[model samples]
Target: MKLVLSPEQRHLREAVRAFLASASPLPKVRDGYDPQVYARLNGELGLSGLIIPEEHSGAGAGMSDLAVALEETGAALLPGPFLATTFAAIALTRVPDKELLTGIAEGRIAATLDGTEVSYDGSAVRGTLAQVLSGMETDVLVAPALTGDGPVMVAVELAGPGVTRTVLETLDITRGQARVVLDGAPARVLGPRPEGGILDRLCVAVAAEQLGVMRASLEAIVGYAKIRVAFGRYIGSYQGVKHKLADMHCKLEQAESIVRYAAWAADESPAELPEAAALAQAYVGRACFEVARDHLLLHGGIGYTWEHDAHLFYKRAKADEVLLGPPRNHRARLAQLLEL
Candidate 1:
C-alpha cells in the first residue's frame, strides 16, 4: 500500500496551509470561535464535508484526505467546531442520517460525540455528560447511552427542550468544552451502538492533529534557535540545545510516520485499522506533548509568558494528549489488541 500522500493530497495540504496562514493566524486563535471564519473554511473550502459522501452533500473523500486538512488545522490552531464536527460526521456515517449529514456538510449543523453514561428509554435519553467537545454550541450530540436491552447510539438536539449546557474553561481555550445535562431530552436512536471502527477512525484523526502540533513545535524552536545567541554563540550551536532539538525532530519524524500509516489503514485496510490507530495514539500523543514541552523550555522564560505563542502550543499539546484518553490508555488498548 502507498504510505506517502498522493499528489492531490500534497496540493490539498498546500491549499489548507495557505488558507490557514491567512485566515487563522496565531493572533486570531486567541479571539475564540468565529462563525464567519468557520463558514469560509466550510463553505468556501468545503473542508467540513471533506470526508462525507457526495450523496449527503459532502466531498466524498476518505480519511487520508481529512488527515491532510487536519494537520494544517492543528498547525494553525484553527479555532472552531471542525474537530467536533468531524467526529459527529464520522459517527453518523455508520447509520447515515441524511438530514444530519447534509446539514453538517452545509455548515448549518455542528455536532460532537463521546460515549456517556446516560440512560436511554425508548425515545429519549436522560443523564449528565460532564464534558463534551464543542457541546456549548453544538446543534446535535451523538453518543452511546445505556438501555435495558444494551447500549445504543442516540442523537439529541441541544436546542430542544430539557437540555442544559454549561461551557467549561479549558486549558486550550481555542477548543471549547462543555458540560451537558439532559433531562429526558428527546433523542433519535442512530444505531445499536457505536462501531469499533468509529473509535479507530477517531483515534487516527486525533493522531494526525498531534502530528501537526509536533511539526509546528519543532519548526518554531528550530527557527528561534537559529537566531537567538548566548555566550557569544548561536543557542542552536550549543551541544546541549542541539541534542534536545534533535530529539524533538526525531520524535516528530516517528509521529509523522505512524500517523500516515494509521490514516492509510483507516482508508485502505479495515482489518489493520484498530491496531494502527492504537499505535498512533500511543506513540504520537506522548511524543507530541514532549516535543511541545521541550519546545517551550528551549525558548527560555519567554516561552512560558502569556504573550508568546509558545505557551499556546504547549497548552494545545497537553490538551490533545488527554483529548482521547491519554497515551497510557492507548498503549494499554494497543497491548490488548496485539495480545502482548
Candidate 2:
C-alpha cells in the first residue's frame, strides 16, 4: 500500500498543528487542561468525534484521520480528557448507546481508565479502578472487567451513585490521573474485550503521537545545534553532533513510516492491524524516548531545568513508552504475530 498520507490527511495534520501551536503553546500546556481549549477542540475542530461515525455526531473519520490529529496533539503535548473520550467513542460502537456516544462527540462527556475490574450482575457492574486518566472530571469510564464468560467491557458513569474518585499525581501533569472505586455501579455492557480491536487501535493512535514527539525533539535539537556555538564553531558542525542528529532523523523517518502504515492498517486492514500496531509500539516507544533524551542532552544545561520544554517532551516520551505496554512486551507480541 502507498505509504504517503492522502491529501485530506495532510490537510488535517496541518490544521491541527497550526491550531495547537496557538492554542496549546508551552505555557498553556504547562498550566494543564483548559476547558475552553478542550471545548474548542471538540466543537470547532470536531476532534472529539474524528473517528466516531456521522450517525453518532462525529466527523465520520477513520483511525488514520485520528492518527493525523494525534500527531499534532503529541507535538504540542495537548492536555485534557481527550484520550479516554476518544477511546470511548471508538470502543462504544459495539454497544448501542446513542446518548453516551453522542455526548462524547459533543465534548459533553469525558471517559478515562483507572484500574477497573467488574462483573455484570444482570444490569450493573461491581469493581474498582486506579490511575484513571483525567478521571477527576470525567463523566464516563471505560474499562475491561471479568464476567462469567470472560473479559467484557463496562461503561460506567463516574458521577453516578456507588462511584468514588481520587485524583492522583502523575509525571505528565498536562493530563490528570485518578483512582476510581465502583461498588455495584450502573454500567452498560459493551461486549467481549479480546474480540474487539479497541485497545489495539488505541495503541496505533498512541504510536502516531509518539512519532510526533520524536520528530519534534529532533527538530528542536537540530535547531539548537545550528545556533549554539562551541569552540568557535557551531555545535551542529561537529562530526559527533551531526552523527547523532542524522541518526535521530533516520529513526524518526522509520517511525513515521511504521506509524502511518499502522494507521492505514487500522482503517483498512483489520486482520493486519494487531501486528502493525505491535511493530509501531515496539519501535516508536523506545525510539521516541531515546530521541527526546538525546535531544535534552544536546540542548545543554537549559534542557535540564524545569523551565525549558525539553524536559516536558522527554517526560512525555518516557511516559508514552510504557503507557499501554513497554516496547519489550510489544516486541514479544510482534514476534508472535509474525511467527518469528
Candidate 3:
C-alpha cells in the first residue's frame, strides 16, 4: 500500500519544521536544557492539548498529526518533555473531566507518567524511574500503580506532601529525565487502569517518537557524509561508507513503514497496534544508533569532540531504544504475534 502522507499532513509537517527552525534552533536547544522551557514551549505551541477533544481545549488531532509534529521536534533535537507530555495527554484524554483536560491543554500545568516501579505498598509508590522525561518540571505526575483490581494510572500533584524529585544526569542533554520518590503521595486515579488496546496505543505513540528520532539521526549522518571528505574524497564515495549508508536507508524505510502503520492503527484499529509498534521499535532503535555512530565516524576527529552534535543524537537514540522496551523484548512480542 502507498504510505504517502496527504497534502494536509505534508503541510503540517512543513509547518512544524518551520516552527522548530525558528523557535527551537539547534543553538536554542543547547541553551534551553531546563525542564521549565518545555512547559513554556508546550503552552506556546498548543502542543499540550494535541490529543484532547476540542471541547476540552485540545486540537483533537489523530495520531498521524501528533507523529508529524514529533518528527520535526526530533529533527531539531529540541529539548523538552515532548514524549512524556504527549503520552500524558493521551492518558488525560481518557478522563471524563473537562476541567482537568482543559487545564492540561492550556499549558497552565504540565504532566508526565512515572511508569517504572520497583516495589509498591498499598499506600505508597516508591521507586526510581530511570528515564522520566521532564520529570522535574512537571506540575503533575501520572503514575501507574497497583490497585485492588490491577494497575491503575493516578494523577498526583507534584507539590503534594510526599513527592520528591531528583534530576538525573543523562547523556541525552536535550531531554531531561529524573527519578521520582513518592512517599504516600496523594493521587487521584485517572481511569480504571489502561489495558488491552489502550495500552497498545500508548506504546505505539512512544514508538512513533522513537521513529522520528531515528529518521532525524539518519538524515544528519547522510548530510554529514556528503560533505566530509577523507583521503581526498568524500567519505560517502567509498564503497564501505556507501554500503553503510545504504543499509541505514533501508532500515529507515522499514522503520518508517512500521511507524506509519502503527500510528494509523492507533487512530483506526487498535488490534493491530502491538505488532506494528514492536516492529517499529525493534528496527528504529538499532537503525538510529547505527546511523549516529556512522555519522560520528564520518566526521572523524571533529565528531568525537564535545562541540559536535553527533553525540547528542547518538545518546538520545541509545537511551530511547530501551526506554519502553528493548528491541529484544519487542522481537519476542513480535514472534508471539506472528505465532512463529
Name the lDDT of candidate 3: 0.73
Error of 1 at 37 (Å): 0.7
In candidate 3, position 303 carries an lDDT of 84
lDDT of 3 at 230: 81
After TM-score superposition, the amount by which residue 337's alpha carbon in candidate 2 deviates from its true location, in angstroms, is 1.4
Q: Assess every candidate by TM-score.
A: 0.97, 0.95, 0.90
Residue-by-residue lDDT tens digits, candidate 1, 1-340: 6778899999999999998899889998999888888988988889988988999999999999999999989988888789999998888877688888999999988888877768988988899999899887688998888889998888899989989999899999899999999998999987787547888999988888888888898999999999998989999999999999989988988888898889999889999999999999899999988999999999998898898999888999899889889788999999998999
Which candidate has the top score in lDDT?
1
Q: Itemize residue pairs with steric clashes in candidate 1.
A: none
Which residue pairs in candidate 3 collide? none
As for TM-score, the candidate ahead, 1 or 3, is 1
C-alpha lDDT (0 to 100) for residue 87 of candidate 2: 66
Clashing pairs in 2: 113-132, 114-132, 115-129, 115-130
lDDT of all the models against the reference? 0.89, 0.83, 0.73
* Residue 274 alpha-carbon offset, candidate 2, angstroms: 1.3
Q: List the candidate numbers ranked by TM-score, top first.
A: 1, 2, 3
Off by over 4 Å in 3: 34-44, 117-131, 149-151
Q: Candidate 1 — which residues are off by over 4 angstroms?
A: none
| Candidate 1 RMSD computed on C-alpha atoms after optimal superposition onto the true structure | 1.2
Give the best candidate by TM-score: 1
Clash count for each candidate, listed in order shown: 0, 4, 0
